[model samples]
Target: MIFSYFSRRRADRFAQLLDAPDKAEVESNASAYHHDAHDPELEKLLHLGRQLRQQMPVIGDQVRPDPDFRARLRQQLMDTAAARGIGVTATQEAEPDDAPQTTSVRRPGLRLGLAFAALAALLGLTGVSAASGDALPGEALYGVKRQTERAQLALAGSDVNRGQLHLEFARTRLAEAVAIADNPRLLPDVLDDMDEDSTAGVFLLTTAAVDRGEPSLLDAVDAFTSQQLPEVADLADTLEGEFRQRALTSLDLLNRIQDRSAELRRLLPCTSSDSAEVDDLGPLPQRCSALPATDEEESSSSENRDSGSQRGNDTPDTPDASPGQEVTPTPSDTSMPPSDGLPATPTPPSILPSPSTVPPSSDADSDDDSGFLEDLLRIIGDLLGR
Candidate 1:
């Protein structure tokens, strides 16, 4: 019971030390309390309390929250309480009204600044893209122009569309070449780019036309070459030396593209998807030796052959006449009667007869004559057929 009394007294003295306003008062009270109690536990507790009191102000300065954060935190507490179906009256009472108003006023300014920055950046890129459209090879924005074209090609829906884009870019490159014609360093490079784009575009367009069996698709290549050829020739005329040679080479390529397009159009009808021969372009057209016969031509030839056979069957076979008797010509026989004592030979039908008619020596000779006439008629029909 006596120890319990001392313990309660010690607690009361420690509580008083906590309330002390200055470090000197805390030190003075703690020394007096330690001397009266001679209690080691209470002395240790008092020393820790004194150290914490001394450090509290430093800790507060370092860990202080921003005014904006405090305002947001209070507002968040109110919002969270409202979300949970709890009364927000207590939270509202704890926070000042002006804090939320200040935050609301500041947020719009920050957002507006961010929006302006983003818009400025977008406009800057757009300006660069626009300026690059007219830029030449060594200009700063030229790479940007090429990159934009590549982006367009990436977004293209089909090879034909991409091919057309490549041709258009090639034209742009040609314009650049003309602009920099005085700059020997850049002229060759620009012309090279132009040639590359032209070749790529022609290959793509021709391949598409061959694959789809649509000769009309080659019209794009023709149009591009026709429009560019004169310009290229004029440029070649203006240039000299190696540059002139380069321009001439580009001109030749354009001519070749035009010829190739025309050839592909002529041959597209003969090509098929399963064609065996293919090049960098699509399938090569099969070389046709002869056009196929139409159904009407075949039917007419069949009818002619049948008629010739029927006529041969209708011709009557005559019995051998005596060598001493005079022979009479039949009504079907258009030839005059033979003057000599010999039998009249039957004439064959003459749809397409040989120039010289010979009397058949035997039945095999007659059959051979009929076969030769039928073959002649069929050849004529095929020649005249569609």
Candidate 2:
């Protein structure tokens, strides 16, 4: 996918030449390019080949240089060689211009390989684009640069006004990302700039997106930084001990954080930056139902704040009661009648028979049974009342 995009223009040009015999001149011009730069003539040929290949599809069989065409092309190559202060080799010693000279275009095996190449090129050239860096828009590049700057500033503990300014800058970066369309390298950073704790946000965004079989958004946050987020690491070792543990990589964490921001925003105040603090560890104890409800409270506070909704795998424990112990599902049942206006009925108690009710072994009959009736009665009464 990446190579196709980067070479699309060249591919199209090659296709055009393939379809048009008159464009043999284009092929002729390309034959002069050879791999060796030490030889001026070869150097010229290499330049022309690079230009031509860069303008044509690297992998395909749509066209071949004609034998007669190549012979004539070699003459043109020699002519160019003479003009460039390089001695032209005799046509006799040079391979036939028209022998169907071949051009080799390397094929990339995966889409990411091409994308990474494009990224490298973008970095090298200071240009970002969906394809080769040639056609990048000025405004988009400026937006990304500004976003990077703002993110750095915001992260340095700047004030709200500075944060807001950074946020606005990030918005521009997002705009640039949208414009460039296929530049995944820009996405992670763009989303990062959208929040003050860009590292966490980027990590989560990368993880979730990768799971969905797409590009990860937080590409730059290192593993160490990603682990710093409470969900992915033991922040108790730091200041976020109240939060849960996670094992996501930095990019994965950031991507996930970004996703959480949307849902969290509906329940909390502040931008994604402020929200990160809450999401990393969640709202403080007063705002969060971190404590578990006791059996009695669980029954009594089903609809109230003490409902004890643990976020993830924390399960409530069952109370230890002997085999036939009765249990109340809720505490408020005794105080409130059924909403349907049914009778304010008393709960039926469970029953447990005394050991004497069953025939005992002849030898065991001598064992103590003093507390037997008392235990039986208590268990029976509790069941019957339920």
Candidate 3:
């Protein structure tokens, strides 16, 4: 157990323990990570590892090649390539057009074997990594850089490891996207890959928690969700079209976490957990009642400011009469009052019928009226004759 880290996975686990953001995460994961129980050496080593990790950035800057060293190295590369009959042109290879073809008997297999051996030596001495600090965009080894990461992620032993690996891979994708910012064609695929990785990381973490898996895994995932996922989601918005859409799909995955979140909370309660005498640690938690409507100040919102009649919304407004029924007029539906344009026409004070309209009394009156008219006409004739 003292020398267990000779195995690659154990070494990786130790590294993860060191990578933990807080003392709680490290201590929580330590028991599962190292089975040594109480090896004083391991404890000391862990403490030393933490200190080294904190100082690594400063050391890294010190080790970087100075400008003078880089210039000399570049000049030496040109001199070497020239001596080897190599061309520096962007599109063409180094070998000259008149270079002789090897038709004679030669041990091509042996030559290939030597080439492979040298490549293996280089890879071992200087491991390929996507985060290879010097691997700028358009460099030949860039593809190999990501390939190394894929190999490592493929070997990840547990879901927790896979989840962390995927997150790292997602970060690598973001870095690559930034590196090739000008490449419209490749940018979308890169961003899509990043989103997928982030989503997968969150999914695995939540699933592990739901299954009552490792507490350390749950805690680690919780940390990432609270700290990292939001930033990645915001980064997604910077992209255009389908790339952004794929990223949105992953953001949707972040939402999926709530399905298992209760389980997560049960497994790993936060420091500020206020369970209120409710043991929510069961597989099925006690259903909490929905929160009351914002009654913080004992709200008077439902207290009416105006009377229901004043607001005119009290009873349903009287329905218009269907077909033949008499309609009752509410204030809203009443007719207008009559105007001064129409006047009363009764000029007679007596309430008597017309004389022609009378029956028996009126018949005698009509006969006398006819005789008087004939006498008046005769008088006019006599006056004329005289």
lDDT scores in order? 0.58, 0.33, 0.45
**lDDT score for candidate 1 against the true structure:** 0.58
**Model 2 spans with C-alpha error above 4 angstroms:** 1-148, 151-158, 182-386
Cα RMSD, each candidate:
32.9, 29.0, 45.7
* Candidate 3: stretches off by over 4 Å: 1-124, 127-139, 178-182, 210-212, 258-263, 267-386
For model 2 the TM-score comes to 0.20
Where's the lowest-lDDT run of ten residues in candidate 1? 349-358
Clashes of each: 0, 48, 0
Write the residue-wise lDDT of candidate 1 on 1-386 in tens digits.
Answer: 45697688777888897788877887788777555746677668878887887798787866545455689888976766665445544444545745553234233555444433333322233555556778788887776676666545543556678678878988998888888887767888898888778866776677667656577888999999999999999998889999999999888778766655655565455433333133322333332211122234344334433432432221211112123332332331222123211212221212212112211222333344344333333333332342
lDDT of 2 at 15: 53
**lDDT tens digits, residue span 103-213, model 2:** 322235444344333333333222232222222334434533433332233223212223233333433433443444343434344334333334223323332222222
Error of model 1, residue 347, in angstroms: 62
Q: List the residue pairs that clash in candidate 1.
A: none
Compare candidates 2 and 3 on lDDT and give the better one.
3
TM-score (all chains, Cα) for each model: 0.43, 0.20, 0.33
Candidate of highest TM-score? 1
lDDT of 2 at 336: 32
